[model samples]
Target chain A: MTLRTESRFADPDAAYRLLVEAHRKIDPEHGPALDAALVLLLANHIGDPAVLADAIAVAVKVVSPQRQ
Target chain B: MFQFAYRRSPDQDRSSPPRHDVVVVGAGPVGLTLAIDLAQRGRRVLLLDDADRIGEGSRAICFSKRALEVWDRLGVAAPMLAKGVQWQVGKVFLRDEQVYRFDLLAEPGHKMPAFINLQQYYAEAFLVARAGELPGIDLRWKNKVTAVADRGGHVAVTIDTPDGPYELEASHLVACDGARSPIRAMLGAAFIGETFEDQFLIADVKMRAEFPTERWFWFDPPFHTGQSALLHKQPDDVWRIDLQLGRDADPEVERRPERVRPRIERMLGHGDFEFEWISLYRFQCRRMERFVHGRVIFAGDSAHQVSPFGARGANSGVEDAENLAWKLDLTLSGGNAAALLGSYDAERVQAADDNILNSTRATDFIAPHSEYERMLRNVALGLARGHEVGKRMVNAGRLSQPSLYASPLSTPDHDAWDAGPPPGAHLRDVPLGDGFLTDAFRAAGCRFTVLRDGAGPEVPGAAVIDAAASPLFAARYGTRPGDAYLLRPDGYVAGRFRAAAAGAIPAALHRARGAA
Candidate 1:
């Protein structure tokens, strides 16, 4: 199945808030590591290679918009 | 308490002693189970132990489904099940907050429960009773081995009994002694690995409480802050509690009832329980360089040890007993002794390594070594409250499961299956007729079995269990009408076939028996 661009959560804003709150609970120095680990963990959870590849491309595009 | 009276045996007075087919040392779960299995396989066993009675306390309380299956083959699972507390759910807590609960066995339609908390003494008693019924088993208590010499083809053993010292000869001598194995020391075999400095206090408390029968584990709870704790309900109104007391706590001072009672009261929030047993232990994850040494063999804790976080000690020992028994029996019955015993060495060493790896990992997670490690652990526990991945990362304990043997005896599968237990894996039990698949396998004598979907092939000298009548079997085994699986004597899958040609069965059987 293609990666769904539409938001799946009933409260997308609350989901975002929860992620931020989780980061706040840990020490400031650990935030980046947590994000990296969470990304890897989520990648494992979303085991579909096509969807993961698509999500990665979309995520990288946000940082380098001009990249072909 | 279960007690066995010491009796005088004629072997003690015999000048030449006696030569036996198999002489098994120590009469704990492993020795008892091994002796029974050998006896069932038509080999006479001389089972010896130094102790006259089962040890007190609720040690090794958690017996896994795999262990129960082993006991079932020996005709002792019924008593174990009837007298033990069965559970599948376990909950984890971080500080005072509950993290997430886990269901060990989510899928149903299995013969045995996921786990049962039976006292070690009761388990041994049942095994002893079963051993007594089998005429091939000659169990002698108060018989301790003082010296063991490997005489190439046979083993010479010197025993010390109440009467005096005696000598015996064994074609195969199996040491099922405990962690501090005297035989292991006598042979001067090296047991290598890590030993944790952290100490944990285990107390078996007897009380009338309405707590649900589930494993409750905690990390830094209010009652016992800065350390982890575990609670499990056992049989006979006894609840086992483990409180982490760091490296500095004096085991002698902590073991006293006066010091232990307050901790129980603080944890239970009441002072209405009596201590049945209490002890302190440090984790030791280690194993011998080789489980098999010349004519003398090592099984159970004598061969390997792991941190008790996963209840793997007794369960893995039971699996060791099962794995070793069949191979030894085949060797004694004029099969290739070298090849078969070599398979045993390879298979059980693989299992011991797997157990040590898992238990060591769990212990590492449960008791982190440094501040950074503790922070990472806390991170996982905190994230577990909101994420499924975090729950997967949290390892209070990875409870004992049967080892999937990537063994030399297994004939690698030649056919493809969508979803089923592959070769070198334990067969998942399914409901067959009135009983279960495991029951049928047990009923079909202790030998290699051919489990088929329908009447496709007739394998000589192997018991056959037809899966045509049971749809559940097909579902579990991922089989059509022509599928068949070759099962080892220890219930491990040796090979599988999509369509049997009758001629292909002998070679697979040969490979499974280590005769290839």
Candidate 2:
């Protein structure tokens, strides 16, 4: 199956606020672990390994120092 | 006020109860419907129950369209539909915000709606009243089946009454005893499955509420913090509410009026509601491996059970009755008994699995087992606010629907049809002249019915209905003139063909009757 790339959120800013609000009570050390957990959970929800791998690659390309 | 009169069973004579064609244990909806259907089909049925009166409480409030059709065959749907609340729309919410709404029955021109909310007690009462009218049904109240012995050809059962005990023999013994089935235990059959740890408080309250007669489900509603809630309107101004209590909740404390009243108050925003019945339940999704054990068969809760989320429990049981009644009737009338019962086991086990799968998924979504699961559920719900895909993923009990039996009984499709129900699917009710299609089938007496759109060669041993003049028939069947469909006794399509293929209809009939 093809990986879905269309934006699902109607309001991206509102979704960002929800994501930030989820991490607001977390400490610096726990924050990374929570983020990692969230990533794994989302990956599981995505289910297809190829789609998840593509998503990971896209994130890495966006965050890389050379790209920045 | 209870309308149905409870009559005590006659004292048992020392000799023995007379041998019967079919002895149905437990006088609940399943057993009663089975008995009525069998009696209508010319089988002598003896119905026994330990209870003196109908079931208490507004248990199993939602009856699906298929179940209503089945009850219609048993001659009780008109009263039920008149008394019940029909609804199709369900709204799902995340906390205080409504995420999405769904219309279950989108198509028009159907006889019954997607579902009708009626109390289980009223359903049983209607079935009982219908059963009393049939000549061949012998209903015995306060008579319990204490001992069961599977004799090679028949089942020998012992009944215990207030006065004394009596022995009886039946060609077939059908167990409709509820989840805690003594017959299942007596036969050493295992009822096995998973039990959800989370408990839910179900309260049936009589109130004058302005809430529409629609299903309203909530995930972590503000009234009941961190737990899911459900509200449904039943007949007689009664509202059924379910509140999720965590795994460690004590059943005793959660059932008290002082505790339940506040939860209802928070949801209703008033103290006008009075409790009709309140109970705490930790539902288990379980079933016996084989519904048929020698000459003794199981139906309803005794055969299988699911968590009450999807309203699969009683509706599936009624379907079980519907599926088995005709098979048993044929068996008693010298049809191939073994193969027909085997088909019943295969078809119903598949249905039970389907219900269990849906119920389990709904439970997990409503009460997530782990922190990770909870996190993912929250994300999904958050996404559901705007995304269609996320809204589709939200499972507030995938409500009960009839499962198409992919059994050996169904004669496979010979040619491709674009629309309407396929082979193994129940015949959709369509308006025909002054009445509906099912009404005609009922008047024809639960036989193999062949419907043709226009002039067609008749198949032997099947009743033919000409639907050439009815556009509704043509639309639902997706048939042109001269196309025909072979229907089973239970109103399921056995086979369909464009023209009369020599020997095909008879061969399909043999397979459907389990004579092949």
Candidate 3:
């Protein structure tokens, strides 16, 4: 099955706010650790390596300086 | 209190020693069980041991259900069960926070529990007591086999007794000596494998506390810093504690009461306990190239060894004895000796490899060898706090289970069955009449058994069990009223068929016995 990029969440803005609020009180040095933890958590939930790799590629393509 | 009587053997003349049908070396749990099983099968067995008494300290504490079943067949399970601690729940902790818990025996209605914790000495004492009751078993203490020579049709062994040294001959010799098997060394066999670098300190302490009967394991905790620790309950108000000591820790200093007491006090919050036994050991995963060498076969730690993390060491050895005993008995009864012994080597080597692989994985996870491994283990433990997937990743110990002997001896299934144990799998115990199916199988001398859904054709020389007696029979067999299963003497399925004739069961039994 293809990876869905459609809006599955009913309210995207509230979900995005909740995701950001989870890291509000973290120290700057621990930011990457928290991000790594969140990535692992979400990857485990997704449960498919192919979809995870595709998601990682798409994120890099959208945010990488060379791609831009 | 365990008491061991020093039974002396009649001195044999130095010129010509007596010959026996089977001579077993080492009177440990494995050797004793094999001797008892063989003698019960009407084989004259001579059991020899270097030590006059049973094992010292609680060397092997965890006995699995398969081991209990084997002991039950040998007529020693009742006393062991009465004196052992039965438990199933194991809790894994990450730095004082519970991460995951497991219940091994989730389903009920089985005779034996998932695991029992008893001292090795108690098991040996019970086995020795049972051995004394058997007629054909000759157990002699302070008799050590110093040399083993495999002649073409027989084996010649040299024994060193307190009186003097003597030479004896037997048709077959079995080595159940410990990891440092003198017979194995005498045979010029090499035990090849890896020896782990880390060491663990095992302390059996006697305390009158009300700790729950469960396995408590920690990756790292406030009481013990930067290492793993495990706590288990045994019989007689004793607790077994294992602390991981890194490669450089001095074993002599770590075993001192002064060093060990503070650690126990920190974990238990009191110093009102006495030390029963303390041992420091490094993990090793190794096995011999072959279990059967001509007429001399090896079992137990003499043949294979694995890390104690999985409780595979003694449990697998007992399985080896159970597997080898019947095959040896049949061979002595004029069956195809070569092919049957060859099957033993093939099956138990596979089991040893499985145990070693599982034990190595558990050891690597518990004591990570590299920084990258440590990082991954920590991440797994950290995520295990809430995530379900991470809980599955934490491997404290896999514990012990019976390994399916997938060998050519098992006849392939002819028809397609939906949901049941496949060929080469152990027979699943189900309620039959007032007892269990395994009880009936054992009552028939554990010979080749023919099980059918209902009575159709008579198979001579095989014990027939009608599956209609138990309600679970139909569900477990996954077949209709006419299907049949031919089982081996060791309770493994040899073959399965649909609408078999009278000769089919006998033919399958011959194939299972490794007849051409």
Candidate 4:
């Protein structure tokens, strides 16, 4: 399926799932979450709402206290 | 009223004080440093960070001789040194077998801190306390920057604060917001490079046993699936351990040592240790294609994200700040053309790539995917162990050496880009240059000041920064009568000259003012 377009989602898991999928596509290795967080943060600004929500969902899943 | 701004602007009313000479975007180590450098230079400066507190992560652990020199210039390298453990040697192991080692402080009889393991939080906190002491130096916390606009002659910044959005226009904006710099993105700067597909767990644990405060690398970090764990020391009995996670991994499973303990115990020696904090990390060997976009400039992670394998991520960002700080000080005040800032982009971007390559080489060595590649690494590791120099060379690879670059700002000396003591000679890892420097005494973190014999070279506007080069005295440059090299405020090779080379020193200083 094509990438979906969604904005900030109330459910973090949903938003982050979208993010993790995008990250998997962008970061095949999945080593540096900071980069993923960065991509997700920027994606939130520039990505489709669905994409941003997905990233956020995945980010919430990954980054804890996750203070950059 | 007029206390903050030591000097006022022409556009200012007779009744009003000036805003500031410059407004540093983030109060991380880089931003605090720039504020300190400019403030000490008698310029009005303001520093801001989104977070109220200093760094909290086990980020950038190893500091190069260049970084030590910058610290020396700032005059606090000693106190910070007191806070860190000095290291000159690194041990590399392939899976369960310990294989090779390398010493950045190869030759003896030099003053420089080879590579230091200190938390970024301590460094930033020290800088914060230092900045607080200086008059006209104001650091604002929780100042989340939203947008930046270059208004012809100057740049304007708008921040989303807890109260309301406030606007502050300055001569320039130094964005140290890190890899995902919103300011840089707003200005449409290009960050180029791909993300690596390795997930690692970084845990700062408190260990009871003696794990000799040196960096130990496990080829296939014998923990949690096919991953590796890195063990090194931080001040206060804290040890930094990195464990790679599987592709389809869950953070919950990796955060607690209970799940990861067996894996770590198998790799190192035991897992009976108090855990501090756990973080899951993913590194991208990506960098901003450009460092500066108009009136705004990027520093630290905002500029690039190198794999943490080689300690390049945070250290290189610090280098970005150190390199840009002096130039920003000179240029932000309208002394140099705005074009001076262009070199920040040109030179640092190269350094970023160098950092990526260094991290890539180290990461690939321990965590190769292909059988052929893995076999080749094993052969290299086995072969190197047989010879002393070979062993050191392999060790150097693990310590993140042999990574150097020639940026636009670097004045190619007759000996420029020649093989330095390593597998590579990129900007980030050089022994603070060829002075009589040696061992942990050789500084990889201070603003190295090499005082050559005869008529010393003159570095025009070269500020003799205050430095406390302690415990790492062996790394200081030019301990010998004839040898000498000075590090810039940030920690790249700033200037190198003979005793009589003083005549060329000022020109080099000008060259150091900005990138080529």
| Top candidate when judged by DockQ against the true structure | 2
Q: Which sections of candidate 4 miss by over 4 Å?
A: A1-68, B1-18, B109-111, B221-226, B267-271, B369-371, B382-452, B456-516
Q: What is candidate 3's DockQ?
A: 0.04
Write the residue-wise lDDT of candidate 4 on B1-516 in tens digits. 011212222322323323455878887777777777677656788777776666576677787766665565566577788888898777777556676665668754434467788887777777777888788687777677788788876787776665656666777778878777878778887777766566778888776767676778765544544456678888888888787774567877777768766655765577677767778876677776677766677788887887776667666766676667767766755545444576666667777776776666566555554443344444444444333322433422334432344544454553332222211122222232343232222233233333333234344554332122322232333232333444454445655544444466666665655523
TM-score of 4: 0.70
Best by lDDT: 1
- The 10-residue segment with the lowest total lDDT in model 2 chain A: A59-68
Chain B superposition TM-score per model:
0.98, 0.97, 0.97, 0.78
Which residue ranges in model 1 land beyond 4 Å of their true spot?
A1-68, B500-502
Candidate 3 structure quality by residue, lDDT tens digits, B84-117: 9999999999877898899988855567788999
Segments of candidate 2 deviating more than 4 angstroms: A1-68, B1-11, B14-17, B500-503
Provide the lDDT at B80 for model 1.
96
TM-scores vs. true structure, each candidate: 0.89, 0.89, 0.88, 0.70
**DockQ of structure 2:** 0.06
lDDT for B262 (candidate 4)? 68
True contacts kept of each: 0.00, 0.00, 0.00, 0.00
Query: Local distance difference test, per candidate?
Result: 0.86, 0.85, 0.84, 0.60
The clash count for each model shown is: 0, 0, 0, 84
* RMSD value for candidate 1: 7.2
Each prediction's DockQ? 0.05, 0.06, 0.04, 0.01
